[model samples]
Target: MDYFATVLISSLSSASILLIATLGLAVVFGLMGVINLAHGEFIMMGAYSALTATQLGIPFILAIPVAVLVTMVFGALVEIIIIRRLYGRLFDTMLATWGLSLALYQGAVLIFGSVSPGIGMPQINFNVGDYTLAAYPIFMILVAAVMLAGIYALLTRTVYGMKARAAIQVPDMARAIGIDSARTNTLTFAIGCGLAGFAGAILLPIVPATPSMGFAFVIKAFLTVVIAGPVTLAGSALAAIGVGTGASVVASFMTSVAGDLFFFILTVVLLRLYPLGVSAKWRIKL
Candidate 1:
């Protein structure tokens, strides 16, 4: 029973983490149809932003807002300067974002040196039978729930959400109706990037921030988002649960590396079966 509890907790924690990481990417991809190769770099930027804010004497909790604000502004700039022109051009946008990813990685290495710093984990733990679980995972579960609720609320009950949906489904008609697709796209992208930044800040204590760290997160996040289907938070959450649980179970049976391999395999198989994603028919009217 204890072992089962441990596995369940581990799976839930992993799901929460993946959900946070993929939420922003899903939004951007679903709305803009732009595969942002630089999405992970925004996460890396968030970790660095936390570091800088803490150095400037900001509280750790407060640094999250600062990181999010900074990342959102940066995302807006990127949209205006680079992504704006490349809209609707998939290959071109991918190449451009790939270059931007490399540039951000190199810039981080140059500025922060090769290895970067990490925040200390919170000193809290709980005992479940003989197994002790870290408090961080519980906190993450809460954060994920709140974020999901927040996203749902934003989409279902806001003018921006309505405009964004309109821009996505029928940009020409929306534009004719006075909905500025450009502005909507920029805001949507910024929000997505901001979510990525928030995930990075949340992860800072768990993983060391490094230039190349984004690669791992980007792979996991992108796969999760893809499997979930674009633009659907419910789909993303369900996919995260499945992927995270499968990976955790594999890890328990073998090794972490094996778990990652299993995750990749599962992703490929699922994609082959459901090319449009598991949530293809259940798309929320955003």
Candidate 2:
């Protein structure tokens, strides 16, 4: 019973973290079909934002908005200067963003050195029989759940979402209806990057802020988005849970790195079966 409970908690924790990390990437890819390889840099920025905020003596809770705003503005600028021109050119966008990712990584190293301090995990724990579970993961679960619900509400109920959806699905029609497709696209990209930053803030304690830390997250998030099918929020959630659980179960019996490899193999096999991905037929307003 104790082992089962531990596994369950571990799965939930992993799933929640993955969900938050991938949400932004999923949005950007799903709506625009633009592969922003530099997406992980936004997450790295968020981690740094949180670290800076902590150094300034600000509470960790307030660092989230700081991270979001910082990344959002940078993302907006990237969209206006680079991404906007490469809208229809998928391969070009990927290559351009890949270069941008390298630049960001080196820039971070120059500015902050190779390693920076990591935030301390909150010092609360819950006893589950013979097992003592950290409260931080439970907090992460709540944060992910709330973020998901909030995103659903924003995409489903807001005017911006309506315009963004219209712009993506039918740009000519949207423009004909007086919707500024260009502006909508810019805002959507910023929002996606902002969410990525927020996820980084949430993960600051678990993973230290580092220039290259973003790559670890990018791989998992990319795999999740691919499995979820670009543009399907529901599918993203389901994929996160399924993948996190599979990885967690394997990690219990093997090394964490081995578990990651196992999950990667599983994802490849599954993709071959569902070529269109888990949510190929689904579309959301975002």
- Sum up the clashes in candidate 1: 0
- Per residue, candidate 2 scores C-alpha lDDT tens digits across 87-185 of 889899999999999999999999999988888899899988899888998788888888888887887789988888889889899999999999999
Candidate 2 residue-wise lDDT at 226: 88
What global local distance difference test value does model 2 have? 0.87
lDDT of model 2, residue 105: 93
lDDT of 1 by residue, 6-25 (tens): 87887788778888888888
- Candidate 1 lDDT score at position 203: 79
Write out the backbone clash pairs for model 2: 30-231
For residue 181, what is the lDDT in candidate 2?
Answer: 98
Model 1 poorest 10 in a row by lDDT: 277-286
TM-score per candidate: 0.96, 0.96
RMSD to the native, candidate 2?
A: 1.3
